[model samples]
Target: IKDHLKHHQTQTTCWDHPRMAELYQSLADLNNVRFSAYRTAMKLRRLQKALCLDLLSMQAACELFEQQALKQNEQLLDVPQLLSCLSGLYQRLEQSHAHLVNVPLCVDMCLNWLLNVYDTGRSGKIRTLSFKTGIVSLCKAHLEDKYRFLFRQVASATGFCDQRRLGLLLHDSIQIPRQLGEVASFGGSNIEPSVRSCFQFANNKPELDAAMFLDWMRLEPQSMVWLPVLHRVAAAETAKHQAKCNICKECPIIGFRYRSLKHFNYDICQSCFFSGRVAKGHKMQYPMVEYCTPTTSGEDVRDFAKVLKNKFRTKRYFAKHPRMGYLPVQTILEGDNMET
Candidate 1:
C-alpha cells in the first residue's frame, strides 16, 4: 500500500486522498471511545503513515510525545495529547530556514503565528485538527496548494471565509516577510490594509469564497508577497543560465541571472548581484531585470532592444527613471489617507 501510494505521491498528497479523510474521521471518532493507549497509538501511527511525513516531522512528533509523557505524569492516550506536542518544533523550524539572517526571530514569529491561529484562547493547547492543518499549511508543497490549504483551514463548512478569517490568514502570512527583513519592501507589517484590499477586490462580498480568495492571492497582496518570492527563490536555487557573469566571470551563471538593461550582453551572477558588486563602468542605480529561469530567444531580442534604447539615454535620464521589480498594490484606505 505504501509503495502504491508513493507512485502517485508526485501528483497528489495524502491529505487530498479519500483514505486520509477516513483516517482523520477514525481519529476523531476515537475521541468518543474510552481512552486506550494501544488504540490511540495505532490510530496515530496510521494517520502518520497516511501523511507520508518526513523524518523531521516524525522526529518532532516523537519529541512532542516525550514532552507530554513527562509533563502529564500519566499514560492517558488522547488525540489532543498527541497533537499538542510542539516542544522542539521551533528549533526544527530554525534549522529548516537556516539561510534566514535572523532565524531565531523567524522562529519566534512562527511560534506566535501558531499561537494566534491555533491557540486563540491563549491556552497553549491546540486541537489535533489545528495541529495537522498548521503543519500541512507549512509543508514544502506548491505555493498555491499551501494557500488553498490555509484558506480551507479558516473557511466555513460551505468553503467561505469572512473578513476576520481572511485577516487571520493574512496576519500569519505577513510574519514570513517580517522575519526575512523583506516586509518593508512590500509594505509595513499592517495586515488590516491587505484584508480591506482583498475584500474590495472581491467586490465587497460579505463572505469570500475559495475562488475569490484565489483571485486575491493571484494579485499577490502586499502583506503576502514574500511567500511567492520565497517560492521563486527556491525554484531558482538550482537554475543555471547559459550566460557568463561579467563581474564574477563565472560561466553558466547558476541560480538567479540578472541582466543589466543599460549594457548589452551584461549579466551578473546571483552572488555578485546580492553582494552589490558591479563592473567598472556600470553604476549601481542602473536598471536590471532578474530572471530565475533561463532567457528565451524572444526575451534576448527584447532585452537587446531595451539595452539599445537605454544606451542612447543620458545618465540623468536613467537616474530619474528607476525601475521597481515588483508590482505595488495601493489599498483604498491608503489612497484615502494620502488624500487626507
Candidate 2:
C-alpha cells in the first residue's frame, strides 16, 4: 500500500512539490495514504469515500464498544488493575481497527455502522484541512468563514517558527488560483470556478482558508520543538554561529500586515526597500534607523526598538502637518534584504 501511494505521488502527480508541503504534512501525519486505490481512478475515489465513511462508522463503533465494555466492567478494579485494563483495551482497539476491513462482509458491515458516528465531523474537517495544504486550493475551493476563524486561531496559538513558516507558505500558495485564473478564462473548466470564487479576496491575495495553513504548522512537531531560543543556544556551543540582526524583529506596525520571512532589524542591502523618506501623502515622519547598535537581550522587547521609534517618531509627527501641500512619508522596514 505504501509503495502504491509513493508511486502515485511520484509518477502520477507532482505530490512532492514544495508548494504542496502542507498537504504532504497532512498525508504523512495521518498515515492516510491509500495504495491499492491507485490501480484505478474509480477504485481510488471509492477508497477515499470508504475511508471517510469509515471515519463516521468508527464513532458508532466506539460507542457500542464502550457500552459492551461497560457491562463487562461493572465491577470496578483497584487503580493498578484499572490502569492495566485500560492499556490492554487501547491496544486491542488499535489492533481490531487495523484488521476491521479485512474481516468478512457480515462483520465489516456491523463495524462500519458503528464507526460512522465518529467519522461525522472528521470528513469535513479533514477535507478542509487537506485543501488548506494545497496552496491556492483552499482559496480556490471557496472555504466558508468558519474555517477562516479556525485557521486564525490555530495560527495564533501555534509556536513562532512554525507559525512563521506557515505564513510564508500561505502567502506563496495565494498565487495558485491566480496563475490558473487566466487559463480558467479560456472557457474550459473553471479552475477558479464560481463555487470556489467565494474563497478569494476581490483585491487579490489568497486569504480564503488559512486554516489549513494554520493547522499544518501547528501539527508539525517542528513548529514548537527546537525553538529559536534553544536553537541559538545549541548553535553557540557548536561554533557555527548564526548571524544576528541589528534591529529588533518583534515589533508590530499599525495598519500593516506582518512580513517576517526576511530580516527586519537593521538589515542592510544594496536592493533598498525604502524610498529614503516617509510614504507620499502620509502623515508621519519616517524614522532613520541606525543599525550599528548593540544586540538586545530580548528581555523587554517593548523597549528594544525604542531607539529607532524615538528617532523616527518626530519625523512622523512632522509629516502630519507639513509646511508644504502634501505629506511626505519616510520608508519603514520595507526593504528586501537588510540584515547584515
Best by TM-score: 1
Please provide, for model 1 over 51-160, each residue's C-alpha lDDT reduced to its tens digit, 9 standing for 90 to 100. 33212343454455445453322123232242234324544544664443243333333334444444444454544444544455344567677677678767888999
C-alpha TM-scores of all predictions: 0.57, 0.18
Give model 1's TM-score versus the native structure. 0.57
How high is the lDDT of residue 245 in model 2? 20
CA lDDT for candidate 1: 0.57
- Candidate 1 regions exceeding 4 Å error are 1-123, 126-134, 177-188, 312-320, 326-340
Taking the tens digit of each residue's C-alpha lDDT, what string does model 2 give over 1-340?
Answer: 2333344335512112232333223433222212111111122122223333222223333343354353321233222232232233334444556554332221222222222211223221112222222211211122233234324433433422233334443332322222222112111223233212223322233343454433432321111111111222222222311233222332222111111221223332101212222223332222222221233466226334544454444554545533221111111111121121
* Clash counts for the predictions, in order: 0, 32
| Reference-based lDDT, each prediction | 0.57, 0.27
